[model samples]
Target chain A: MTESPRVVGRRTDVSGPGLAGAVTDLVADCAPEMDDVLVVPDCHYAFHPSTGMVTNPDVVEALVEALASTTDVTLALPDSQWVEDAPSMLGYDALADRTGVETLALGEADTVERTVRIDDERHTVTVPKPLDEQAVVAVPTLRADPDLAAAMVTVAEAATGSRERSDVVAASAVVDPEFVLLDGTYTFTGAPHKGRFLVAGTDAPAVDRAVAPVAGLKPKAVDYLRPFGVGREAIEGLHAEDLAAELPHEQTDPNGGEQPAVMGAGYRLYAKMTGDLVPPQFSGGSDD
Target chain B: MSDLRVGLLGAGNIGTVHLQSTRGIDGASVVAAADVVPDNRARAEKQGVPRTYEDYTDLLAEEDLDAAIVALPPFLHAEATVAAAEAGCHVFVEKPFARTVEEGQRMLDAAEANDVSLGVDHTIRYQPEVQTLKEQYDAGRIGHVPLASIARINNGPFAAPPARQPVSGWMLDPDATGGGALMDLGVHLFDVLEHFFGELTVEYAHVDASMDLPYEDSALVVVSTEAGTQATVSAGFFQWETPPEITGYFRLEGVADTLRSEDHLPKQFMAHAAKSALENVSKRARGQEPAYFKPTYYYQAHYRALKDFLDAVAAGEEPPVNGAAGLRMVEHVQTAYEMAEGTRAAANAGANVEVTDD
Candidate 1:
């Protein structure tokens, strides 16, 4: 029988407990059959000034150190944001300099020019898109601008020569005041796509079940992930039956916590204004 | 006094509630109950009903009754009520009267032909709070009523323990319940609205019904009367942990008095401007008291309706809450349901269906 795939997670929140560490412990306790490990920083940290993307320099150093000691390990990052600032080139240069590990850039011919300003050395390198055969380009948070969303529909229609609007998936951002940056939304119309994590196999129910708690979100908050070909119905179909016996009992509290009073008040106004018998926002979907 | 025997058609929840209500109402006795379910017969026995029959005709034929309470499901209401009317019995039926306007008309026809007193249990109309509103409006205290709103948010009937039966259960089934909250609760609100203002013409309405359920669990209906009075009724069963509460408030154009009910018991009418208006009216009419005053007792309005119906039955005169009033309520509910169902279908079809907007 084929073994379960090794999954990696990144802790997005800064103040809370590290999500990666939590995931590792939970996986060890609940899903022992799957082999997983958390990678930590070793020496040199990586930072992207433009997008505010930060990676532990020591973690990259440890990964390069591991390449010398281990041969069969596959290097993986959390998402597309990690690779925004010449990540492959920087990683390759670091590894080659430290441990003579041959760096091969494999992919189609699309040039990405970057100027690296190091101590007394300036170098420009043109790299191609990472190939599916050699290394996969994973984009965990691929948020779409509203303009891009409309453009995607136009492009999809042009490619397929069909006027069907249902054939396109749209992505958007749902920016709340508190968590403005990380809030993203996606929608898929016709079929699922690749280049993103497939939480589970063909079973939409299983995929949905594996997402929450693993992703640290309620099922309703995950609707934005639908447009990324994540199988929304599968996620929606997930019930308590699909979960493992050891999963913590869901909270029974009515209000959940001291959520923003405006959320509740706004929802009430929306209900009255729309004459909606039940407020759609409060129905556990994206109120945005 | 001779035994005032009665037969009951329908052993459903409402039927059982009626049975309990009937026990308290003097001079009425439920002799036999008939229902399609054998379990319903057991229910009757459990409720201390003397005799039970599977067929309503059997109960009508066997029981020497003064009246029959037709509490069957809505679809079966017209047939059972018409049968009771033909059998020469005063009929007390549940709200919406029948499933369709046509069916309601037929029941009315039967009652008219037999010359039997037909009273509808538009229970909300009989609600003391609603009665207070009606009394004030009729007394011209709340001068020409311009806009009224009736809002009822209850745990859908099926949310209750007794109602939480299988999917095929009577209340859950559309054919049995007739049309969800709009029919069940909306009927009552419509009756109250029509009672306050004369017959209404539904200018526009927007209804958003349930998707997963076979019937609508919620409805939002807006209607206007022929006399230019507008009203909105929002009914639903999504409330989680609250006992049902119905709030009816209307705005009068010229009247400055504010009518408020505390704990739905004592109704208070207060107004600084209307005090002079009231005093002038009271002075003009020597013996007549100022109509805009506080209610003396609790639920006096329902008691009045009950007394009126009983008085009409005793005098062989037409009952106050008649078939036509019930029919008008049913028609409004039907229109709302149709609007909701149509909107939902269009939404599913991916068509831009614009709901009625304010």
Candidate 2:
């Protein structure tokens, strides 16, 4: 039987107490199983009540520096606006100066194709039509031809300053890929594109699960995913199921299960689909 | 078993500690423990106490006890002590004698009428280091106690439940614990300050009691005594580890000194200047005993207090740390809580609320 693809989910929510350590623990747990990991900057979420506005720029820089030096991983990022706001990107020039990986910016040039440019090298790549407008820049690399892997590796090595050849190898592998990781929050309303299937990366599903109690989403939300075209057919389809199972029942129950009105009739329906109706992992606990 | 039998009321965390302390006293034995909770009775029974009573009244009525340690919740402190006092028992009550000054006054009146020696557990002041500091302050070793500051920040007691628990828990419930860290721990600092500087009024103070719990958790209290001495007392449930440290800084006009001690532990100077002051105090208190001039005081002060109380009971004399002393500490603590409440109300209303001095 074919082994399940070894995937690593990065937790980008950097707000609240002990979250950074939690993310570190999650990454450490996934390290052994992961073939190629995508390390994103610790993202900022505006609505977290506990820590109103947290900026763990140091954490992102640390993660990027550590991933660049130690692991062979595919690092996919959003546009310049998103990248510039990222803590890791502030050190991109220095990282690029040391590592030879080329930093690329992707944007819409016209209806036909998207434009990709290496900031330092001034190198650009333009792909053909029928492209996913919302797919972002990483889509082109995932769909790129096999021969482009060598060129992409050379570019990534120059941009990242990683001496290890495997860093380039993972970067090359993710370029022009078949599957696209989408934000689970927006997937339902967002349109799907041709040739690429939408999947929740390690972080998106976790966030979706984490926010479920607070947001008051129902089983219909997971069932709604297939129809909304955002998530998987069932919550079990997400990779976090095994990890979710291990979390304490108290930590997982949102609203302290005190307000049954919020959970509604969808509770049992979602319970069957998710197997465990709640995100077992807590933001703050002894284990965390 | 026939001599100096002690009846313990409450059987909670502090009550259990009192029972442990009593076990070590030569002349005293805990014969009976009483609590409202069945589990508490079972726990007391496990400690080898022969009798356990569900009602404290029944325990007081049945046992021919010479003394009783009143360790019930703050709101119940007055009632329990008054009951124990009327039963002709010398009472050893926990700190912060009552929830309010009026209640404390009434309880003290009852003890006085009954002619029972009533002592409050002002444990910190009984510490050897604290005693040494008090001796120094009194002997004018530190020149003159100008500005004194006591700071205590602890993660709270081992019995404090996790933060996630409901706000109505015993510790958070004002009716039960009487006002969080300010009442629970601040009383210790107040007792020490009163011991060193006599009676005082709060001149300027700021307290953040409404932060996390329903009761006040943090307080910064500034007091001015009749002699015009100034003292700042700060306490909070903010530390993350055990055996919480209680530290103090005293800035005299001619000299400055610092003193630190943890619960049931040795007291020592953390700064060089404090060392010199402590040495001077030791030399004067214990002349020619140079071994006592080590800039540190070592002794289990709580155990000493327990021993003293036991000795007083045997001799039919008054306990050294009387309930009136505990009442005064509670009065100062209530003022601090009022300060915090006034500040919070003013902040919420977007205007300054005048805090009345009691």
Best by TM-score: 2
Off by over 4 Å in 2: A1-288, B37-43, B157-168, B209-211, B244-299, B344-358
Over A137-229, each residue of candidate 2 has an lDDT whose tens digit, in order, gives: 121111101111112222232223231333333332323322222222111111111211112223322323332322234323432122212
Residue B346 displacement (Å), model 2: 4.9
In angstroms, give how far residue A177 of model 2 lies from its true place.
25
Specify the highest-lDDT model's number.
2
Error of 1 at A24 (Å): 18
Q: Candidate 1 lDDT, tens digit per residue, B253-280?
A: 4345645433344323324223533453
Q: Is model 2 an incorrect, acceptable, medium or high docking prediction?
A: incorrect
User: Can you tell me the CAPRI class of model 1?
Assistant: incorrect
lDDT of 2 by residue, B1-358 (tens): 3569899999876676676567656688999999998877776776668999999999999999889989887778889999999999898887777878888888889988998888888777776656766676677765665677776666443112111222223554577677767788888888777777788786655665322235555778888876556888888764433122334333333255544333324333335225543454455456432221122231245556666777887888877878878888888887776676677778799986566554
Report the Cα lDDT for residue B213, model 2.
39
